[model samples]
Target: MPKHISLISLLVVCSLWNMPQAVHAQALIPHTLQLDAENLERQGLQLAQEAAQLGQFQQFDLALPRARLASQLAPNNDRVWFLLGGLHLQAQDVDAAMAALEKANSLNPENPDIFFALGSANFQQQKYQAAADHYKQGLKLKPDYREGLFDLGNAYYMLGRLPEAIAQYNKSFSQDQKFWPAINNIGLIKYEQGDIESAMKQWRTSVEIDKQAAEPLLALAVAMYNQGDRQQALSMGEAAIRIDQRYANLDFLKENLWGERLLSDTKIFLELPRIQAALQQSDN
Candidate 1:
């Protein structure tokens, strides 16, 4: 795995740096009982930094022990609890993540980031309402949080609240126009609502924004095949898979929120000799 340097580590380092000289000495040395507490806090921050570095590379197994130790060493430190929460969340230990994050939130409820991480954990657990609620709270704290908006949109989408989902996606786009996931998700809603033309337009615009993005390209190619343009569809489909081989599977397509109509159409398209040959050729 690639070595990682996480923002959590930087933030911890900065926090330590910002301390006064006297406290810094106390944090480093074990001269007295009071100083020992400071020393433990400093050690916790170090352990938290190590956990974050490992977590960044998806080594949650290795990261979790360090995060736990950090939290134990500095029970009052919100950042230490937050790191534990993040590690648990990454490892899909939703219950543990929520517990740690709840502690972090109690320590610093004003931090919108804790709510966002809670929302993400809820989302992964398929608790859409909880996710939406957490996202709403986080967004209220920081209205321009683009990822929070997008995630709220996803929660709405999962709840079958299409219009609300689109509204959230549009809000995200307003904040950062180049956010391709919002554009792509809007296409998903449009396609599901039987607006193929609008969906195509969105997908095309999405592809224009990021040529190597496989999501919209696959959607466009499937739409093209459904519209009876074999050669163009085959070429586009080939290009889509070339950009990301994961797009070649039905499960992956469904995960992208391709509606049943499009899924059925794509299944038919993929069975064509031309599409198979072209996709096979591209793999080589």
Candidate 2:
């Protein structure tokens, strides 16, 4: 799955009130005009900061207008355009997001985060190839960016390029051993490839890394159930559901990248009387 949109902080907030005026005047007209433009830019930065702060609080409705105004006021600042793009993404306006992000990329092609954002936009549109290409471009600029690597892996998985997906997942995991999502996704790919035992091992490792991770826990439960370890699987599945009930939904599992084979097994496991009862109990 793609990571949530993170608020960008490329520009620092500036206030005209805190700026020191020139003690000795140069060419008065041009200098005064330049100061006005500078003040507008500073105000734009301030607005952008406010939008980002609101976004951190999940106030996208309020953030969007401020981000839009920020871009209008700071048309030359890539940071403002990037912020606007992020807000558009939050609003689920993928086309608008792409437009703003492309503007930002045009303004500052060296910034990898814009490419990452573009990759996310494409991923949401189900344009897997485009998403992977954008991620590759961003990774070229910042090869060790763990989240970018993970997202690229997801795109590759969606495209059915399993080997490339696994490579990206491994790269992401190498960046931080504690990132269990990468491990969990490896399990997903393994299960899809009919290597049930390998898939179970990967899920086990993911659970070991983060015991509270519901996805891997439930996946392990399903694998164990498929292997005829019904009693223990039921116990584990119950625990996983209690930790997070969303995993009980097959659609949610599919959204999380569970392939058809694993999903078929998961559906059967979820339909078991014990698991169904557990789901009911969790709902209570």
Candidate 3:
């Protein structure tokens, strides 16, 4: 199988393994039975919010059942399903997240955040085409939805439609110039297309926009190294390592640019032969 496909499959399997079972019907019961259902629902929501704020993902997982019960108690409140969907997303239960988010969307179709979450779940699951369609629908509903545009650009990028990716990134950046990921992704696409100068310019702009981000620094270094500017490349590469020692593909850069500095960087050396083969297969 193609490497990326294999990798994705492996990730899916691992995620499935780690996923908690769908909360059983019995699990949705509240501890204290009360006639004042609205008050009980309000208390359940408050607990859910507390769990989310504490970053207690497992607690959030447990809290979702109560939230759903609360929704049952107060069938008219849209916030109950919205919170349930957000909690399911935090739990990485995509199917449940989609269901709850769709329910929330039905209640509040004009809510851009619901579409954004649905788009995000699809994107994470590698349903690129579906993600793009959802993002497009979201943008249609809310023209300045920067998150939708950003994620839509990501879907296009993963599909290897670089021009479309760039257009989406540009649209996202127009809404918020400080959107570092889009800027970094634009640089990445230019680098992949062999436009080293333009790539470096974009990466530099990205770094200017978000000084703490390591991606633009690493990408700029790679672009510089590819263009034979070893000194500047080493400088930027070292800077990136200092910012985020665990930056992805740092070892790949070091290996490719060996006989130069940054050799001691403790990043994973991506096998180029494998990468090239995967790219070739993707093109097919």
Each prediction's whole-model lDDT (CA): 0.85, 0.89, 0.68
Q: For each candidate, give its TM-score against the true structure.
A: 0.83, 0.87, 0.69
Winning candidate number (TM-score)? 2
Residue 39 deviation, candidate 3, in Å?
1.9
The digit string of per-residue lDDT tens for model 2 on 1-284 reads: 01111111111112223435533232344555566668777888999999999998989999998988888778999999999999899889999999999999999999999999999999999999999999999999999999999999999999988999999999999999999999899999999889999999999999999999999999999999989998999999999999999999989998898899988998999999998999998888
Report the candidate with higher lDDT, 1 versus 2. 2
* Candidate 1 TM-score, true structure as reference: 0.83
Model 1 scores a C-alpha lDDT of 0.85
By lDDT rank, best first, the candidates go 2, 1, 3
lDDT of 2: 0.89
CA deviation > 4 Å runs, candidate 1: 1-31, 274-284
Q: Predict model 3's lDDT versus the native.
A: 0.68
lDDT of 1 by residue, 121-205 (tens): 8988889999999999999999999999999999999999999999999999889878888989898889888999899898998
| Candidate 2's TM-score | 0.87
Kindly report which residue pairs in candidate 3 clash with one another.
Answer: none
Query: Which candidate ranks first by lDDT, i.e. highest?
Result: 2
